[model samples]
Target: MGNILSSHSPSPLSDANPSFHYLVPHTAYKVFINHRGKDTKQSLVSSVYHNLDNRGVKVFLDKMCLRPGQYIPQALICAIRSASVHVVILSPNYAESEWCLDELLLICRTGAPIVPVFWEIRPSDVRMENKNGVYAKAFRKHNKVGKFDSRTLEKWKEALRWVSLLQGFISEGEQGEMVEKITACVARYNEMASRQTI
Candidate 1:
């Protein structure tokens, strides 16, 4: 009779092979832009996209790629998950659109970093505490479905200011200050990737 045998967990490195353990290719950092399609012309979203693209940043803008007859929600979720960053272009009408709110909720739930540009609106207008504002209403409705707090809002604001510097929106005298912040963020991401490589 064959000897009785017991199964054992494999060693952590048992399946490791040189070819399989080779360095993963560094893909271009993708950025997904969430904005109202109607605001494409003369909107901050368009301007920021242009600036970043000009600087060789890879960005995914819906207006540039959304195909007709396609399911937008699915396409957007795919893009958001694939992206390294999500840029939300906030305007007075932004909260009025269910699609924009859905996109924001998805970004929040996915734990993807967000950069919210307050275009023609104040930060207070986007915060959840402002119960009477447009953003407040949207947030109130959103809270029923998911968790989002002021900290998340502030994080988005920080990201926005951080990216704005990279786009050269700061004054000539204050440009260095902004550049320092943007460089720090870029350096942090690079360091994270280096650690993963090791």
Candidate 2:
């Protein structure tokens, strides 16, 4: 992960109702985990969600849902609005999905701090610059990557590095350190929000 942007706000736990939209009395950070549904590992998501929840970090995950007919867009937008952090789990299949790109675009537009978790797929699989790149072509063709050129494969690695840095997912050895950094980042934001009330 590159430099993780620090929030100027206080902690979220200081508030009475720390729900995403409540203007949490303290600094409440709602994190939206964006990823390909199929790629979300039970152990990984469950562990992370449990850990964050236990630590009072509000997490938005698709697995925790209502009935099939519920209005997903409204709920998702609301969650995004309430969150201060957005985590994008990047994988080959991630860019293949229109929904993931929409979420990424929305989060990016919102100015929320984004954390990209690089999964099994290499970063090059998601470059946005080249018109024929996987990510670029997908967006251009309305999220389709079937006709991508083979020559661009090498260039995709650069795109992956860019995306990883843009989203703050560091190399393998940095994973544990990154988590600690993120935890502190969230804590700092919550603290800042808390001070606003003082």
Clashes of each: 0, 18
For each candidate, the alpha-carbon lDDT, in order, equals: 0.52, 0.54
Write the residue-wise lDDT of candidate 1 on 1-198 in tens digits. 011111111212112233432232322346777777675335455665665666566667777656665455555666766766666666666765556655555555555556555555566565534568766665556456544455443343333333333332222344345334443443344345446668
Q: Poorest 10 consecutive residues of model 1 by lDDT?
A: 1-10
lDDT of 2 by residue, 1-198 (tens): 222212211211112232435322222237777777776646444555666777887777767743364355545655666777777778656665645644555565567566677665445545554556555554455323434333233223333444566745533664456556555655555555456658
Worst 10 residues of 2 by lDDT: 5-14
Off by over 4 Å in 2: 1-29, 65-69, 128-163, 170-198
- Clash pairs detected, candidate 1: none
Residue 26 Cα positional deviation in candidate 2, in Å, after optimal superposition: 20
Residue 94's lDDT within candidate 2 is 68
Using lDDT, give the best candidate's number. 2
